[model samples]
Target chain A: MPLYYEKKHQVQFYEVDITSQLTLSSLLNLVIAASGEHLEEIGVSSEELISRHLGWVVTQYHMSIKKMPEKGQTIYIKTAAMAYNRYFCYRSYWLYNEDHEELIEINSVWIMLDLNTRKMVPSDPEIMLKTGAEEIRRPQKFPRIKLPKEQLVADKSYFVEYFNIDENEHVSNAHYFDWMISSLPLSFIKSNHIKSLDIKYEHEILYHDSPKSYVHFNQENNRSYHKLANGNLTAAECVIQW
Target chain B: MPLYYEKKHQVQFYEVDITSQLTLSSLLNLVIAASGEHLEEIGVSSEELISRHLGWVVTQYHMSIKKMPEKGQTIYIKTAAMAYNRYFCYRSYWLYNEDHEELIEINSVWIMLDLNTRKMVPSDPEIMLKTGAEEIRRPQKFPRIKLPKEQLVADKSYFVEYFNIDENEHVSNAHYFDWMISSLPLSFIKSNHIKSLDIKYEHEILYHDSPKSYVHFNQENNRSYHKLANGNLTAAECVIQW
Candidate 1:
């Protein structure tokens, strides 16, 4: 039998856009929720998926925003293991109309590690067997990132929007990624496998002030260095890898 | 020339899901917000969209979900006029990435609706023109929903999970729809266009009790109906236009 898992999710009124289609972000949300459902179904809670010392960490995803369904569109999500290799585990995703036929696919990889020691751990063989692993491990790889100019520093500023702040009262990581990656081209986005992204905040980005930006890029290593500023106030720095 | 209307929006975290993606509910929130944005960008306000005891109401929508970007994706939206005639006007939507490439597309029709009267009105020519009239009025249409059937009515038996309850302390409408529609085959969902849905809640669905359910389906009309038992007391009637 083909390896498959399916879960049903409802589209709330809030999910609809002017064209009545679900936004791309919302689609990812449903995909995550469905993945949660799958884990829950198999008696693998987020708590269980974690290492004895380390929590689960999502390092990088080379996801394609291929297609989105409409608002109030009932989505059926399917997920399965493609392989467990190298420092990462490969998983595949498919979203389809309720019928479980036509599919929209998302592919990603993740890892298990000792949280306290912060070292990669061999995946639990028992857990892997239960989750249906048929393949071995290999070195993780991704496409190169196309960075912009090598020396573009903060000149234009951005006033933090109220929505940019999350429940944590900080600029959300997702928003930061969106803002950063958006300045680049989709050609770059589609081509790269995000390696590791390290972002550090030197200061809080407030809602009242217009935050300016600084940027640096190196095409050779495919790294992008970024900064956010407001007047002389420095807010944050990020180094993206692919 | 192509019609143009710019909209400004904010990003909220709760609107996103576990995959750390934005959810459909958040997309709907954006739509609502964009309405205000649209008017503001055009040098008007929602106050103008609302006439003397009148407002534009969405009667029906036929849309396709194309793609959902990741969480925190900040997209630019614009509206254009497709057609307008007499009491009806058609609108088109473009969701663009920051670089200005269209990421999502949608089409809809609106009416100069009388709020209190709940009726379409033949508005002034200049007003329609200002809104970007696309074409003359035609029959506003969508997939037809089937009439609901009365199935076995049971009372007081349901399980409410932690996620089922939103901040509102009641079962979310999305979850309600999820359970209501789950009973039917995925095939029905595949073939049918969800024409319309009307639901009224008489009481709160608590997390404590197992809520009862009644199933109803009419294949000819392509609809499945549902009712929830009220604490072994009474039930709420639901109508689904499939």
Candidate 2:
């Protein structure tokens, strides 16, 4: 069985932004969806995991973008399981245009959680074997993202709505990026392009939680840090480099 | 060329709400997308209209929903142009589950606009002839939606974001429904099911415009009326029956 899987998708109208380019949040969603499809093809489907009282939760993500696709364009997304340690698994995703030119590359880390106990678990031997991944082919190690503790540069409050929740019954991870990027000035987004992003999922935002986003920008490094919070609880922290 | 066109789609995770059922706004988007594809198949595509300095603009809509599809389900959307008058073209859409069970029925009215002049135009002879519609098969006329003109019960402001805009360089018609529905209380939406909707598009909301939505619920009729506005200009009005 092949370790890598690829899928083609036609960009829908709703996925495009005002500039007619794909939004960052939607791009992440496409990657996650493709990863799920790949998992299903390998026999470790979400249904199978649920039946075992287990689930995969994303922990860290680092993505670099060369170009953003446009509406009606057909793009290919390729994903593969790179490696797995005792408690975490590594994966990589690549996006290509119709001409086969690579447009984006992403590396992600995930951990298995025991749903019944609500705690982290070691990688299951049978599940890891099904992925067909070679430890020797693992990608370079991902660095931990660091966000400076400082006063907020900008902030916004968002009420979690029905559409924001996923089948997992919590706020989808991609939306945290949405709230972070949206907090930036419109002019800055329209004039500049995002080069790279690093995000760390710290806490899960449940339904009915109105989380406030705090942003801090580092002009010297051209980077931005974001924290999503509900009262004293921090839901997630992210850093973006443009 | 057949007058009816059918397309199948797998419901994605983002299209579902907290209940795992398709959101009403997403359902409307599916219908509108199917209508666009039908037009493309008949050679009256958006490109053709733009080349002729014209565009298709929706004016009114009436939809009735019997059931909402769940995530991961494959649904078939069927659409057709029913009839056309001197200035208006009527269309109908139906959604069916994988088992061929009908779930939704929608009727809509559209008008041709002179893009250069920014005004309504008569239906072009060539365009109408290409649709292959028969006047004898027209559906029942849609009733005008009545909304109370009294004081507003709830209101909220929303800034038009990059993702809200479409290829036309303005807010897409379907997003108006999204904003209107999202304005409702989350608890109410989670517990209740939407049965029918009536909407009328009055004005266009442009980029960078922060429009506010005013809502009034009628306890006696079990209906809600909404008005979207950008300061002095009214963007749209909708009446939803649950």
Candidate 3:
């Protein structure tokens, strides 16, 4: 078993929405940063990886939520690299309250990209060993996400700004989640709490790309299907169980 | 002298821009939240103030920046309620490095508002007393700000989203700073760092209000004047020295 890396965070007022609950995108960003810190402690800093012309890109996330962290709530974020195959690395993240009760669980898929070529590259076993993740022959399967076939319920266009781009010079993955979730109606967002989320990123969005986020809500299943697209090209697709 | 409350913060990755330096708006949010915590600790919580149909609204800010915080850098945030007159209260904030070197200093004006009537109210000396601040007879003078009269350089329309609103049911004040700064050209933002900033809030922007951010740049002075307006009505105005 891989050793879990843990970090503590107190939810700030600015991180929450009007409902006093932490925004979904902010929660994801916190956990992702924790993972980055974990890698830094293990001597595999993102900067070092970038210097080597390689970087980890998240392809998918499957999250199960017990309770969304609220403003001023202190929680522990834990992450570990579970296993890796030739092309994909499997990782897990958990959020727990101070009392040690799990608040959220997430399983994610990451693949190394040759930054110079912008193509998938084989996993570096030497680096994976440093993270204490076991080598696996087969990649783990994540939940499949499907956009609803029904008519679109809402859509909003987002003009990418300089702040949206990270050090990678591309729109950060978590902001896509923000755009997707914010596309829904305020009434629907206030009345519902997300129980689970499954998202798959298909394309990288660069600055100056004005992507439109579309949402389709399935009332029968309490599910919302979302798609973020730059013109006709889909950038991300997500399914949220409310 | 008022007691200064100090808070320690390690800049998170998400708080920084592509250049790895903290965003201007994020820095404001961090310090503003620190002030909220300071109020909470003083037993004059914002919630209690709101419950009494009272709220503190920031009217103006004058900031001098020595350096912007960078990602992964830990710094100290300090705030103090300096003094209050009949209507306006003066407060100061400082950001310091670990060596106690001052990085940023800000002077701000705040006014008490009657939330139910949405009108200005007299200062609540009882609440001010708890902060260990003095009751001065006269208000402190802040630097005057004037918008440039030159032709408009850039204008961008922003649609307020659900997440933009805070617990107060209005667009969070710090977000206005984001919109103003983002309206400038990315090239300019990348090349220049703000030396000082003076901003005044004129009106509040609500959800569904599509405000246009306009910028006027004075090339001779390296200054940018900004205004956010809904149609012809102004919401906020700012001037930044680079």
Candidate 4:
């Protein structure tokens, strides 16, 4: 039988990085959207998943970036069940190029929740089985860290805009990091994929005047920092592992 | 029967003013992307749109925006065939609210191409059927005017970054306008959707110093001017119709 979910997308020129490769965030968006479409084909959808008071929220994901595809290159995405326990539903994702063996793999875990109440709940066994994704027996340990402080780092001045705002009505989480790294000269950004990132959303940022941004990174520890200036608005702190 | 040859989409957040209404170029992108998607589903795609060494290119389009949408509101987009003559394939579009009353309407034409040759081609019957989006016949039309030489009227500024650069290795067309508008004082960008615009691509603003952006608009003619300046790099020009 054909795979239950498969999508081939052509990278648009708008989705490329400075070096002309697809950015990590763009790849992530494509993967998630493809998964959402996959769920829809298998009788589940983000809209229904939330409406049924059954939501899948990412608790933790440890991803490794090996390489990125170039702009205009077509890529295929395939997903399957890894395994699941009562609390953690494990899933795996594969990214492939034209030849099909060129694959990038990801192992991720999600928690089921009661949307209205915003409470955690175990996976629905019947629902999980119907989807037929491979389930993993052992859950991997998530990278541990201290509580990220919401503070400014790089005192670089900048202006924020409308496109940075997402459906959530604030500057998107991904856009913040994009701003942080883009602040560096283009040559520096062209060679990076933001190896790892840990961010804590402390306060919502509103659209304002001459918005300011700060960045801090320790090449030794491989950690980066981002802090936005929104007076009275809660500050956001992010930790980038690259 | 379910429609096979076409689909319609509304002008929403990504394409609209802060009021959630529509912008002129965004109105163009909305129909272009949607219609392109429809064509691709049927085995024809923009990638294959070029023939005779010529590809379809947007030489120019003019629109007059009378109204736009409000934030969190829904808008309707109806697209259909206008007319396909020798040199250009005409297409038409309209925007409406939930009540079905019209908001903004447009009519534009695209040239047939020979991609390899970078030259024009006549609309052959097979080519027209493949890329013309011929199913819907009742598209709307609105008045258009001559765009000014420069879109930069009132002079506000913005900085270019990695994300601002698109696959073309240049600032994305839409983004130039997005930053120009967003850089405006909050009082100006408060609306959710944009009404109308007259823009022209003056130069390809490259990713150097991530150039600075400038904006000038006279609200009187609904005439606005936007410029992307990185010292000497004047990346683009746009005129807005209030």
Top model number, TM-score: 3
Complex DockQ per candidate? 0.04, 0.53, 0.76, 0.29
Which ranking of candidates, highest DockQ first? 3, 2, 4, 1
Instruction: Write down the TM-score for model 2.
Output: 0.91
Find the candidate with the highest lDDT and give its number.
3
Position A79, candidate 4: lDDT: 75
Q: How high is the DockQ of candidate 1?
A: 0.04
lDDT of 2 at B237: 84
What range of 10 consecutive residues in model 3 chain A has the weakest lDDT sum? A146-155
- Per-residue lDDT of candidate 1, residues A1-242 (tens digit): 12457777556445433334453345555666566556656666665655356444444444443345665567888887566764566666777887665546666666776867867776666556656756575654554333343577553444443344443345543344444544444355545544445554445554446666666667888877776665676555566666
Q: Higher DockQ: candidate 1 or 2?
A: 2
Model 2 per-residue lDDT tens digits across residues B8-110: 9988778888778887768877888788788888888888889889988888888898988888899999998888877888888999998899998888898
Clashing pairs in model 3? none
Residue-level lDDT for A128 in candidate 2:
75
Ranking by lDDT: 3, 2, 4, 1
Which parts of model 2 are misplaced by more than 4 Å?
A135-140, A216-221, B135-140
CA displacement after TM-score superposition, residue B74 of candidate 4 (Å): 16
Better of 2 and 4 by lDDT: 2
- Model 4 earns a TM-score of 0.62
Cα error, candidate 1, residue B226 (Å): 42
